[model samples]
Target: MGPPERTILGSKASVRRPKERLEREERPRRKITVLPTGRQFAVVRMDPLAMVSHLDLDSVAIEEASAIKPKKYLVYLDAPQDLPLPQSQWCRFWVQPVATTLRPAVPEEGITSDMVLPIHPNTQYAKGRRLMNCTPQFPFPHCYLWIRSMMSLRVRTKRGVDVYDNDKAMTVSIDSHVAFMSAWNEDSRRMFALRRAALSSLSGQTPSSEGKLRKSPSPEVVQPNAEHSPSFATLSIPPPLRIYRDGSASSDDEDTSQASDDAESPHAPTLPPIPPLMALAIDTDVFGWAADPKVPFVPLVDLWFELEDHLSPDNIPSPVELWREQETIGA
Candidate 1:
């Protein structure tokens, strides 16, 4: 026993340990695919007046929409088709009339007898849980219902002094485009942006053309410090010393020049007995200071040196016979 009986480190010890560990850890990394279901519950029938209100009266063409025929139209509520919670737990209806092109009705003028003003739903709510849920119909939970179809619905005459208010006359006119609106909340907007980015990345499109896009800066490459530079990131082990000795019963008076020539000549007609050569290389990795306080990066310097050395011409292991040896050792 030498000193404290320390065990001698063999060649493949480091190689087998990491190979087994890395293979086990790298097993499960698969891709996931998800599809979106485009469904919505409510519809908002915007009024022409809403659009007119948003426009600047000084520059707008208010009289341009006078000849346009007004009819009942439908604008389905199109949410971004995705929600933060997977399922929508709460529902709300936001109403904003188109004001850019639709002008508000004057107080003195009355709704026209020939004009068609589709009444807003009296009561509206969602119906189904995950898919299609039905909201309430009639006696609207929120607004006062006003349905007016001058030709079909009978008009009631009021006995008040003001006959103009009682008379069914449509005076205020706004552009028809003001009757449509886009629906989305803050969370929905964010998810829509993410979806748009993913689609754009797949199709190779610019941000401006896509409905929504993301802009992220590229990572910067850093230069290494001269003081900290080692060929590898970590500290390496020194190679083992190999000693070769040749002993032969030969004449002591033999010419030294002839022996040297026989060993060095590549086309020599005669050959001498080969000498035994031993080669050993060992490697180890040391930990380095982490850029972040919580995370650490390991530096692998000569970690693979021993493995590469063992497979060299001087130390090549028998592959076919090594498996049998390993089986016996494991058994």
Candidate 2:
């Protein structure tokens, strides 16, 4: 029969399939639903530097402004009455107590009328009674609202600015910390989540070499607390002069010795006593939205306020004090 029935030892049926094809077949397919054109959201572009320029002031002026007690006001988000309930919730959720300081435009002191305006004249609805510096009582909610609402929400401070007329109310956008949070897309959020998971997994695992390296080092040679030695007073003494037998060169020897000493111990480098690091335990669960997977974005409002409190005039250290602190740290 056709060449002894063609008894093929290695047939195509015996060959193994490619790993990539098998993996692709075994992999779970992700369902991607096409969103309607109306459902698609767009990120509003903002020029942070341009916005900051509107609120620019000299350091001395800023210091003076900080001294003045900020006037409190209840800012209201004027959303359309016919708007859907979910969309209108921003009026309550985002709108909160805000503080504003009166910064009147003085034309005489090189401060023109335009300098006092809340925003640049080119911006829409950029009218304000005067240039009033505004900050939200709760920065996160306000920033979230501003970002989500396409930066269209205005700061209508009628009571704070002593203006009863709704038409003339100080209508300006919150531009101070707008750059803190961004409207991240789904892909960005997914990538961030993956990276965070990878980092967390790596943190729990100990490398194989770690234990060996730890045991290899001698205990006496490697002091764990060597950097944290007790504080001692350092004395600044000139290098001892070498008196050579030849009369031609005691001064040169002294100079050379002093140069070498200076090079070896310039500033007589001293390690400062490092204070024990006290962990500040914070209850993050208080922020309900932070851990919520449904809430795609979380504003960095928590960090902003904490930093603001520390950087406040009362808590802030002077330049001289900072210099002294740096010297103590040997920085």
Candidate 3:
């Protein structure tokens, strides 16, 4: 159960319900599809900071962009659109969303490429010489769609690893208080997710633990109420995933921490809260080592995503103001 609903993008919950939307046009060879399942969303790739800095939230329709705690969806944008070339030989696209949420699974004790993402034997570099960057371990062709929520178990990378010509939908289900995202192309250390949490408690408090604070594990996860608007929709987090070493994969239900060690997670450094009105800046490593160890890799790929915490004090009324009954009626 949750509190009463609040209007988002200036609209009510009824407006966010799913509708029979028309299928968008697609180009040959390349594809982009938004399932008519959850709330409406706009997916485009650009330096979010460049656009958000000039964005006027007041001018935007107050009728809620999505539900208060919106159901997530896949924002497929793998179109062959022209992207600005990187300064060097390599380029990276670290996918992040301003309005979305996730609960990143922490990297377990022992993790490998096959465990992180599936490795197909037939489609791998051994068989497909034409496939660039294809390694004995890393077989994925390009960055695809993925969604990691507070309750997700494993990734879909392995869903069709064995199926031949398996064009099986590597789709994502955007559940309530969930997140939709692009494939995680970075190493295990850098892998993290967005967290859908109550920002009201975090609004006043600064980070007490090394400029960061995490939610304590609870059996009953708090579900966001569409009726209530939070200061921010979600949080970026270092969550843990199932583990497998010499044995098969299994969940260590006893552990509740995000990542185990510091050195193990250099990519996901301890982050500070983004200042008021500033976008959350994140860098994702998209490096692919070459065959020869002697060859020096000059240009390292990195994708940057600047996230704007749309939920702020200015938009939502303070609790003190909402409950204060006009100058206090003399105690």
Query: Candidate 2's residue-wise lDDT over 34-67, tens digit each?
Result: 1111111111111212222224335653444334
Q: Which candidate's lDDT is highest?
A: 2
Best by TM-score: 3
TM per candidate: 0.16, 0.16, 0.18
Worst 10 residues of 2 by lDDT: 296-305
Candidate 3 Cα misplacement greater than 4 A, ranges:
1-73, 76-220, 226-239, 248-331
Residue-level lDDT of model 1, residues 1-331, one tens digit each, is 2333233467532323555567889987432212111121111211223223334433333343222233221112222211223232212211111110111111112211111122233223211111111222211122211111000000111223422220121111222212212111332354445545555675698545675534332211122123322121211111111121123224433667677778789976665644433111112111121122111101000101122222322322211122222122112
Question: Tens-digit lDDT track for model 3 on 14-104?
Answer: 3322221222323223222211111221122212122223323333322222112222222221211112233323222222222121122
| Candidate 1 similarity to native, TM-score | 0.16
lDDT of 3 at 243: 26
lDDT of 2: 0.26
How do these models rank on TM-score, best leading? Answer: 3, 1, 2
